[model samples]
Target: MVENRARGNTANAARPGSDAGVLVVGLGRFGASLAATLDELGRDVLAVERDPDLIQTWSGRLPLVEADATNADALVQLGAKDFPIAVVGVGTSLEASVLITANLVDLGTPLIWAKAISAEHGRILQRIGAHHVVYPEHDAGARVAHLVSGRMLDFIELEDGFTIVKMRPPQETHGFTVGESHIRKKYGVTVIGVKPPGQPFEYATESTRIDAEDTLILSGDTVLLEKFARRP
Candidate 1:
């Protein structure tokens, strides 16, 4: 049985091909978080979940329906085809995840983001037409590892091995202009910005001096970024 508990203005619902709204399938941790964030951002979101308990828990908080996303008929009933973007956050059961993703693909959801537990799972999702595959656990673990291993304040890994990090300026860079320190030439990393204590962040330039007390925002290949952050 499909139970819709969506609240809000139906007139404001996004039309097909519009980027104004998103359909999230599954109310697992990832899906719930994503939906909440989107809602906070003021985007129209409709969440579909199979579990009645999960639906009840999120009721009045999110516009959602109680329906198994693996069933294409249920999705059709929910106007899934009209949604420009969809996220498949069912990662617990690989079969269910695949089925839900496949159903979304068949419904012509223009953009599909799916969660995968492993490389094999990710590959399958991509092969089946998931526009984006996220490995939340793997990514969180890597981010935490980077933070604990060095003096890094934060780390963000982007596609193609590129990475960005926030860390204190190395002792070698103290009191020297960016060009004089030769950080990019020596460490193969570019200091993109700097944030001093109680001061607004500013873009880094060749003439911008690095202070040991200031935080540096650097970008480079993952390996080089890690090596540079390890500097004492």
Candidate 2:
């Protein structure tokens, strides 16, 4: 929401200029949507695009650099160092993504969110100091697989030994508030949230009751959750 433009350096007053306004590398569908979303939310968005056409298209709406995001020198000349938070959204070109992520890390970006093509790519990004790495497609596919496999409702991987999962409530769970379920002792999983049919889900309170059709967001080991998900 940087309404006041002070010279070439416009400080996002809300987040501050020093806060590392979001820097998005790459200009594809995902990149465009992300940039547009930020702009809509009054966030100052600076982007780097390797493709000339893409850069030209978004330059008017956003601060775009029509150069390879992989080049440190090129980015330094174009104001990349000013931002601390960056995302490498180059999905099609794996080479560019790797080099650009590496270059950003070298630039000392405090928070780097990189998209990985596979687990191997994720490992590479992690090794290079990427704050977090994700394979959106792979993760989504895992959820879909679970649905088809008829196990859990939703599965989210957190740190090791901890996971956030939604389980299909059985008849026993019906008419029981979260506190009454004794979830922690019974399932060895902590019920952190709940999702009931035809209703929006939110963090589960002690009073949150479990309906037969409700899905629970539980946190614990994946193995036990899987076992619970399969049990009748």
Candidate 3:
């Protein structure tokens, strides 16, 4: 059984206007990074790890529960059921990730995010009730492919056939007002914002001009996005 190291009763941990915080299972790179980022963002975070030594290493930094996250009772004992969000981050262990996700689901956690080793693993996670499935390896590979292709500065796939992309404005479109570019009419994409070199992002408007090095943030259907990307 893991010791309950939460500052107070799990049911009462969240104040009236505050959230119940997040529960991170596993202590690997993904879990650690999520926990650290949540803590940095001023969220309450409780981390779980099978290895006591790892918890000791992270002592004084994050609240922790030393136990096997794959065990449903272990998680229940840690008061994980009350957390608003639960993340299963045992990237290399599909079984562990699935088990933790199942436990969180049974606990009625509002949101569950699980890391998957492959598409099949992701499907299993979703079937077992993980609200979000992340494929870090696949996503990284896609990002690298985009960068190597020299068309995309950044990429986010919102769904199967829609994407949000950041890329340099087409050379021919330079010196034209945003409305004059006819991007929506010509390419079927929406320019949401512009990023000039060394400056903050500026939301696009009718009068915004496209400069030589300005990057554009756009959203559109996948086919249209690919067509737009292939442009020089």
Model 1 clashing residue pairs (backbone): none
For residues 30-77, write the lDDT of model 1, one tens digit per residue: 999999998988888999998989999999999999998898999999
**What TM-score, to 2 decimals, does candidate 1 have?**
0.89
User: What is the per-residue lDDT of model 3 for residues 40-121, given as tens digits with 9 covering 90 to 100?
Assistant: 8888889999878888888788888789978888888998877888888887877788888888989888767788878788
Cα deviation in Å at residue 106, candidate 1?
Answer: 1.4
TM-score of each: 0.89, 0.71, 0.82
Order of models, best lDDT first: 1, 3, 2
lDDT of 2 by residue, 26-134 (tens): 8787777777777777777787887888877887888676887777898888888887678888877777888888899789776677877777677766666666676
Residue 30 miss distance in model 1 (angstroms): 0.6
lDDT of 2 at 141: 79
**For this target, which candidate reaches the highest TM-score against the unseen true structure?**
1
**Model 2 ranges with Cα > 4 A deviation:** 1-19, 56-63, 126-131, 177-182, 193-208
lDDT of every predicted structure (CA atoms): 0.86, 0.74, 0.81
Residue 176, candidate 3: how far off, in angstroms?
1.7
Give candidate 3's TM-score: 0.82
Model 1 clash tally, residue pairs: 0
Model 1 misplacement above 4 A: 1-18
